[model samples]
Target: RGPQSQFTRAGVPAGFRSHPGSTHLNYMINFWSDRTPLHEAAFQGRLLHLRALIAQGFHVDTVTMDGVTPLHEACLGGRYACAKFLLDNGANAMAVSTDGATPLFNSCSSGSAACLKLILQHSASIHTTYQLASPIHEAAKKDHRECLELLLSRGAQIDLELPDVGTPLYSACMARAAACVEVLLYSGADVQIGCGPDSPLHAAVLGGGADVVHLLLDFGADGCRRNAEAKTPLDLSKPNSSVRAALLSRGPCSLSQLCRLRIRRSLGKSRLHRASSLFVPHSIKDFLLYQ
Candidate 1:
């Protein structure tokens, strides 16, 4: 027999298929009818029920047909208590769903910074990529600045390049996430990193990110940088737009700015954060830290 017959044998109420046109009802039916009790508990954020199920010997890592474990559901929903319970019961933080999203990816995509921190403390790999996009890429694309910062502080690669989406900076620009773009830039992301017929500047222009365009220029982005189509970002900008004007007005970096950039680069990306604490004039410190 097929799955329907099996459900019948398992005492499922008859007429489950009676509402074929009711997608929402069918979804509810699937949620309750198909998911194991443990999976349902986590998805519903029922902390006490989850604990009881764990005490009754249900597996903490139980997954659905799509390979989404209980912990994945908890994190995806931003259920702190449910996630904490699941983690304490030995749920696997690294389990990937059928679509390649891990719990960390779900947490980042959902903008759950607390859940993200928990997963990171559990040794979730910041380098893990889902469809060629890392956790930071997911956070950046979704405009999850807190999650992005958490990932970066945990040693995520600032320049992680995706197959089609390019770098986290590009993703931030495409999403018009100004704060995320600032964090990535201060972390030493390459402002000129190319993304197909677009650099970060082009991505900002395409996303109508005038503020982001200004920020990029302030960080010494090359306005004249061309893409595969041989069109500079200025060429793609809208006529009479501030972004266009910003790009057009950009010029060569002065010697002082160049010296600051060189010193920051020589200090290494990880060590550049220390420049803020150095004993120097506040202006010099700002230049050193890319303020």
Candidate 2:
């Protein structure tokens, strides 16, 4: 029997299939009818119901037509218990949906650091192999600082770039995610790497993010850099906008700031966290670590 028959056996009401000419109804039917009892329980965070369905012989890894597993639904909805239960039952954490979203990506999408941590721990490799489904970028763009921080701590490339999304820092700037932008900078993200030819400075200004524009400049972003449009961020800013003022306020990098950048670069992204254990004075250590 086919997947359709399996679902029908699972008590999805009959007659959901649309007539040959009704593609829209067919799509709607497939979207809703393919969801099983396990999917609903996981999505709604009904732990007992999810456990009951699993006890009733529903496979933990069973997926919908779009490849959304019960684990995917749980993570997408930020249901940590449901996700944990599914994972313990041997659900595939690295399972990519038809849309290229992993359970980790959905966890980040929901801004649940707990779910994200669980998925990361279960999956041994968190490489950028799934570039289209970057959990770090999703976290940064959504301003989930704790989630992004946890990913960075676990060896996520600080400057991981995607074909469509650029680096996580750029994505954060474009989204006006100020807290996330600061987190990325402190984590040693490159300020210059933006989406293709666009500059993160340009993105910050366009997003009306005056504070983020300043943050980028503090991290050594070049204000003179032009995007594909041949416009500097200042040119894109409104004449009297705070973003314009922030862009214009940047001067030559201070000597202390330059020293901080150099030292942080020497430490590199992976060893940056160790700066906290350095033997320097508290203020100097804070300065060096961007605290």
Candidate 3:
């Protein structure tokens, strides 16, 4: 029987079409109504229904309402059987959703080891970017340590920087996923690369992860690195006395280095300040200085 007829037989709500006007709703219905059956069968570790879908010429490449393919959902849901069936039926394992996310991305994002293994078997790109973040970054952000290990074992790039200019280690530091940060560091991720206005150390300080900051320091992350606003990670920590104390506990040299860097930055700022004053009227400058 067709997927529509099967849903009707299974007492699905009427007017529920496999293809809907709204992409999000259609994606959900495609899974819950038609694709969900296959997913459930796969989760039960059954292949009979999957085989039937293949026989019925069901396109394994079919996209749901949100442009997510069945493979994407199957991998995210950890339906190994369904994923295998789709792969066997010529489903493109590397197919990206509307958001440029692949099944591998979904698996990592969901922290599904089974799904990750199946997708990796098909050679999913370990470096694919999704919504400005890589799968490794997403896994690290979520503290999916197991998934991080699995991806690394499969040759995932430990230092893969996303489009937003952040690495997996940076995301882990930002999310305060200490274990994940450790894994990435051991795997050879660079701790010094700045993402936007903060390096991993800065992110760790900003996120209140003193342990991660210490870990980064042990890994040789430069504490004196100034961000775009000329604020060192130390300066960013002043608002939180606890974080400041933690940063201070690292020792005097680090603090001195940070202070010197900040002083140099301030000198540069003063130069710019003096240059801008040249353009201002003397009267206005006197008034501003007095104020």
**Ranking, lDDT, top scorer first:** 2, 1, 3
Clashing pairs in 2: none
Model 1 C-alpha lDDT versus the unseen true structure: 0.78
| lDDT tens readout by residue for model 1, 128-209 | 7465536888898788999999988888888877768799999999889999999898888888884765789889988888
Instruction: Report the lDDT tens digits of candidate 2 across residue range 202-221.
Output: 88998999999989998889
In terms of lDDT, the best-performing candidate is 2
Cα lDDT computed for each candidate against the true fold: 0.78, 0.83, 0.68
CA RMSD of all predictions: 7.1, 6.6, 14.9
Kindly report which residue pairs in candidate 3 clash with one another: 23-65, 27-65
Give the better candidate number (1 or 2) by TM-score: 2
Q: Write the per-residue lDDT of candidate 3 for residues 1-291, one digit (tens) a residue.
A: 125324556444333444545322122344443444444444454577767654544455655444567677777766776777778777788988667788888788778887888888887788864646478877899898999999887777776666565878888998999999988765556668758656888888888888888878765677788887888889889664776777777654555445534433343422423533556677644432222
